[model samples]
Target: MKDQSNSNNDPIYYQEATTLAKLIRNKEISSVEVVQAHLDRIAEINPRINGVVTLMGEQALKSAALADKAVSSGEELGPLHGVPFSIKDAIDTAGVPTKRGSKIFEDFIPEKDATVVTRMKNAGAIPLMKTNIPEFSAHWESDNLVTGRSLNPWNPDRTPGGSSGGESAVIAAGLSPIGLGSDVAISLRGPAAFTGISALKATHGRVPYTGHFPQALSRFWHIGPMARTVRDVALGYSIINGADGIDGYGIFAKDAAPATFRIPGQKIRVGWVSDTAFGPVDPEITTAIKATAKLLADVGCDVAEVRLPFMENTDWLTPYFNLVYGELVPYMQQYTRGRESELHFIGKATMDYPLLNAAEYVKAEATIEKLRMHFAGYFQEYDVLLCPVNPMTATGHGLNEYIVDGKTVSAYHVMTATAPFNMTGLPALSVPVRLSSETLPINIQLVSRWFDEATILALGEKIQTGSEAYGKHPIN
Candidate 1:
């Protein structure tokens, strides 16, 4: 396998994506060279991480050459001019296979680019490769029959987090400085936290999701930026957010950005809650999150232990799942019913949700509405809230089920902190917080009010500095 060291010996690999974009603008380095560095990194490490499944190296180089021509000709530069990025397999790319990490669509190449993909290209970001994901982008883990499981770059023995697992793994390993990830609830944020990358889920409807498969029908799905640093995420967000002809949601404004990616100075109101209106957290994860809250307190942030009354029971979680997974049955029955051999086990699991009777649907929606209101009230006073992304860090892949703390759990129990946000449509992020006992990366989640994603990234940056995931390179 080729190595990154040959191509990426300079400090450019460590620079923020935005910083590299400027270097391209100034003609200090050509986009072609940058693309080569990323391709080399992917070759050297991707076999182990399994992050990128479909490489567009030739296409990327072609794009980079064109970018060089533009610069040499003194053309006006786009916001992300000459930067390289990848996409979760779930997002479509013109003439490229977007398998959504399923065997069923391994041969499926799209005739058109997803809305965000088109936008990124227009902004001059070179398309690098297609990252991996679970089948149909259903489960939280990045394992499917087609591409296999994505291992954490930090430790091969652990998982990288999913369905944006490939996106997270690639960024954490320093392959591509930034990439796109879709999150119905926690896909973008969860994997970021697990892999120790920086990411932003963005406000609901901030970025268009028009060519994203499966979540195409999802009202709550969001396609946003995932990168190694908060500033990189912001730069990507600027490039990707825009109205698409097919999307009902209007394009996001280019003007909005937080003053800083990391919070600065005087104590801001911060709230900490280990348990939630969802499932229980793993003791290790819980302790790590609480410790982070305390760390922030030491940094002079006004930290308080807060609670959301609605999270005290599980009555709402079942329906929330039913509404999401329940809706999938119809799509699969139409798309995959006669084609079972084309699907993975989790795709079958997703199809099983609609089997729930109308009684189940009624119950799920009723509880979801109440839970949404209950949590909305909590945002009245807090600037941001912190919690565990999942009860546990990345675990072994391919288990049909898990035995969490000795109790038999459903396949979906691990996504405890994630799905509830889908129910409420509130923006949240899983910020890498601290190292665990095994020396793996563990993350704390931050949830902000509707349209308040700026605060989430700002606070996440502060935590990143303290955790040391900010400057530490996985390949180093």
Candidate 2:
């Protein structure tokens, strides 16, 4: 597809949120014009990708009219004034149905917006629609009985990774400029990589988790931004990063500052890892990650190969799953007390696991702390860690195993590379690096210390600006 992003006369569908905001604020484009452009884009593309499950066309245009009035009335405008963004169906949107990709909550509509959604609106972003997600966001692809499957714009046969799959897909397909998504595992980063976009999983509590489903796992879960560029992700992060006083996890980290992008003048210490102890990566993905490292090195960053202790096992998988089931299963059981049969199959299976006792839970928590400290020490020497977002690129839908180097492994293996950072509650940013021979996009993840999202974002922006693959649009 020819790139529409650089077409100045075109309607605002493919423009970056940051760019759209500037045009709207300066009266180059009315907010109504911008919203209509996206609505028309959705009309054309949503049938194929199914990325936007529930559109707010009437509501969005109404809001856009008021936004234009404000702009013409000489009222102060926020940074994202008049830009339209989508929310993952898993997050609440006041008066909008948040089905969360399950029949159980198909009719459920929230009376209040999620903290992140409200922040976006407060910063002058308009809600365009509720994007699709997996059942309770527990799967690898964004498919559910409620909203069906969200297809990858790059290749319909492949999945846009979940639970932020729809968010990533819509942004990549040019239906929306920016989006809100949450991640406990690889939801945010995986989908961004799969769709060839950018996303950030800020430190655990940096973005409040209020008004999201299955709120029991707040420690590891995070809500953040998915966009077409690293700077836009940073823009969204700056607006949403803060304590909302409702989520205790968010309240504890009141001092954490938002990260921004700046080209580095001096050499930045970067630690690079291509393969973890868990298994081998797709050779092409490894090559792409190393190429990214060399790109950073070419820009004067000091890059070196590094390994972590117990990385062969990567304590994140087993113990993290244990804690997840231990805390979440009971909560899910109680939440679906009367509607168990309507729950998604994955949700039902999650409740079937025998719950871990208090001691086991503590042991799992301790293991996570140990992993955190190990990374804390590692960050003492390195500014950021560059790694692959997934061992392999986006694959065909509904498969339960991945063939890596001719060996079959559980499909969940993709989470091995990303879940570790979630376990450590660190900030990790994923940006597209290169496309494989199959023409699918691959990304390298940059991870920083507990609250140092700035360093990682800066490095990610450097890689993004220097790579030719940056901002390459997928076929719609």
The clash count of every prediction, one per candidate, is: 4, 0
Note each model's CA RMSD in angstroms: 4.0, 2.6
TM-score of each: 0.89, 0.95
* Tens digit per residue, CA lDDT, model 2, 219-301: 88989999988989999999998888898988745466543232447467898887664357888888878888898889888
Record all residue pairs in model 1 with backbone atoms less than 3 Å apart, i.e. clashing. Answer: 243-251, 277-311, 282-391, 319-364
Off by over 4 Å in 2: 1-11, 252-266
lDDT of 2 at 398: 87
Per-residue error for 221 in candidate 1, Å, reads 1.2
lDDT at residue 136 of model 2 (Cα atoms):
85
Best prediction by TM-score: 2
Residue 457 lDDT (model 2): 88
- Candidate 2 minimal-lDDT segment of 10 residues: 254-263
Q: Candidate 1: deviation at residue 426, Å? A: 0.9
